[model samples]
Target chain A: MDKLRQHIEDITALSDEEYAYIKTFFTAKKVRKGQYLLSEGDDARYEYLVLSGIYKVFYIDEQGREFILQFAKENWWMSDYEAFFREKKATVFIECIDAGEVLVNTLQTREKLATEFHKMEHFYRAKLTNGYIALQQRIKLLLSSTPQERYETFSKMYPDLGQRLPKKIIAEYLGVSRETLSRLYSR
Target chain B: MDKLRQHIEDITALSDEEYAYIKTFFTAKKVRKGQYLLSEGDDARYEYLVLSGIYKVFYIDEQGREFILQFAKENWWMSDYEAFFREKKATVFIECIDAGEVLVNTLQTREKLATEFHKMEHFYRAKLTNGYIALQQRIKLLLSSTPQERYETFSKMYPDLGQRLPKKIIAEYLGVSRETLSRLYSR
Candidate 1:
C-alpha cells in the first residue's frame, strides 16, 4: 500500500485521510507465474495496478495464435481497457509472467475516486496522456518500421523488458518471425 | 466556438463564465483542401479540435509510401499527439482532405485550463479515455485480424469515415493492397 501511496504521490500529493480512503477502493491480489487474472469471455470488472510483477495482456486469434497487446510491469496499470471501460466481456487475457501482487479496483471505484478528488483526476489524466503517446508510437512502428528498425527501437525503449521477456514473446511483439528475431539477436 | 462548448458540455456542464474563459484559450483556423496543418520536422505545438471538414493524419516512410494513421472529422481532435504532449518536433503530418475549420490550443493552454477547472480536466480525461480505447482496438486489428476482418471491422466501426475516404486511402489505413481493398469492396 505504501507503494501505491508513492505512486499517486509521484503525480499529486494526498493527505493521509485521502490516501486511506483511496486505498480502500483497491484490493490486493497475489498472482503466481502462468496464472491468468483475466481470460476471454470473462467480465473485465477490475483494472490492476502492478505492485511487483510482470503481466502480459493479449488475445488469441481464431487459429489459436497469440498477439501481445501490452506488457505491464511494476507501477503500470493493466486491463483489457476497451472491455473494462465499456463494461463488456473480455476479448483479451491478462496473464502473470512473474509472480507478484497487484492492487485491483473496479470502474466504479476509479470513477468515484476521480470524482471525489480533483488531484486524482489529474493523476489519471496525466497517466492516460502518456499511455496515448505510447500507443501512437506503437501504431507508427506497426505501420512504417522495418523488422530491424522495430527490433532496435523496442530494445532501446524497453531494455529491461528485453532482458526479462523470452525471445519468442519479444519476436511476436515486434511482429517478426522467430528466424528473423534470431538473426537480429545474433547481429 | 459553440461546437467546442457542446463537445465539452456533452461530458460535463459548464457555466457561461467558464465557457468564455475556455474559448479564449483556443483560436480558430480554416484549412483549405490539400493544405497541411502539420508536417514532419515542424514543431507540433498545438492540438486541433475539428469544427468542420475532414483531415488525415499520416506519415511517409523512406520509400515514399504513405501510411494513414487516422482521419479526423467534425468534433474530432487531431494532432501529432506524441509531439504535442512532449513538445517535440512533429513526426507525422496532418493534412486537410476536405476544407474545414479547427480550434487550436497549445499544451500550456491545455494544462492551464485543466488545472484551473476540474470539469475541464474531467472532459480532457474522458476524451483521452476514448482515444486510448480506439488505439487499443486499432492495435488488435493490426496484430490479430485478417485483412478481410480488419476491413469489415473498420467499415462497421467507422461507416462515415469509410464513406468519406477514398479506396486507396482506406487500403493504406487497413494495410491491404489496392486490389485486396477493391475485392473486399466488391464482395
Candidate 2:
C-alpha cells in the first residue's frame, strides 16, 4: 500500500483523500510462476501494478514464435493495454515469469474513481501521459537504434529487468534473433 | 476550424465557451506535399491537427530506411508525439503527403486550456487515451500478425490512408519490403 501510494505520488502529487479514493479500486492478487494473468482472446478487464516478481507480456507469431513485448517488475504496470482500455479482446498473453504479487483494478472501477475524485483523475491523466510518452520513445528506439545499441540502452534503462529475463526473451523484444543477440553480447 | 471543432466534439462534448477558448490557441498553417511539419532533433513544442490532406509520421534508420509510425488525415492529429508531450527532442518527422492545412497549438497554450477549462482537459485526456490504445494495438499487430495479414488489416483499418500514401511508405509502416507488399497486394 505504501508502494502504491508512493507510485501515485511519483507520477503526480496526490492528496490523501484522492489517494484513499483511488485505493478502493485496487485488489491484490498473487500469481504463481508460469500462471497466466491474461490469455490471448480474453477480455482484458484489469490493469495490474506489480508489487513483487516479474511478468512477461508476449504473443505467438504465425510461425508460433513467441515475441516478448515487455516485462514488468515491481512498481511497473502490465496489462494487455489495448484490450484493457478499449474494451476489446486481448491480443497478448500476460504470464507471470516469477511468482508475484500485483494490485489489480478493473476499468469500471478506475472510471468511477476518476468521476468521484478530480485529483485522482488528474493523477491518472498524468500517468497516462507518461505512459504514452514512454511508448513513443520505445517506438523511436525501435526505428533508430541498432539491436546492439538497443541492448546496451535497455540494460541501462532497466538493468534489473534485463538481468531477470532470459537472453532469448530480451532478444525477441529487441526484434533480434537469439543467435544475433549472443553474437552481439560476445563481441 | 469547423473540422477542428468537429474533431474535439467527437472526443468530448464541449460547451461553446470551452470551444472558443480552444479556438484562440489554434493557428492555421498550409503545408505542401513532401514538406515537413516536424523533423528529427527539433524540439516538438506544438501539436498539429489536420484540417485537410494527409501526413505521415516516420523515423529513419541508419540505413536511411524510413519507417512510418502513423498517418494523419482530415481531423486527425500529427506530431512527433514523444517530443511534443515529453519536452524532448523529436525523433520522427511528420511529412505532408498532400497539400494540407492544420491547426497548431503550442504546449504552453495547451497547459493554459487545461488549467482554465476542465472539459478541455477531459477532451485531451480522451484523445491521449485513444492514441495510447491505438499504439498498443499496433504493438500487438507487430507481435502477432503476419506481414501479409498486417498489410491487409492496415488497409482495412485505414483505407483512406492506404489510398493516399505510396505503397512503399505503407510497406515500411507495416515492417515489410515494398516487394513483399506488392506480392501481398497482388494476391
The candidate that wins on DockQ is 1
Scanning candidate 1 chain A in windows of ten residues, the lowest lDDT window is: A170-179
Cα lDDT tens digits for candidate 1, A70-121: 9899999999998999999999999999999999999998999889999999
Off by over 4 Å in 2: A143-146
DockQ of each: 0.83, 0.47
What is the two-chain DockQ of model 1? 0.83
Q: How does candidate 1 score on lDDT?
A: 0.92
Worst 10 residues of 2 chain B by lDDT: B114-123
Clashing residue pairs for model 1: none
Task: For residues A1-187, write the lDDT of model 2, one tens digit per residue.
Answer: 5889998788568778767767877999999999999999999998999999889988887688888888888888888877887899997899998997999999898777766655556667777787787776676666557788889988998988787788988998887789999999788
lDDT tens per residue, model 2, B50-119: 8888888888877888888888888777787768877999888898889989999998998788767666
Q: Give the runs in model 1 whose Cα sits over 4 Å from its true position.
A: none
Instruction: Score residue B127 of candidate 1 by CA lDDT.
Output: 98
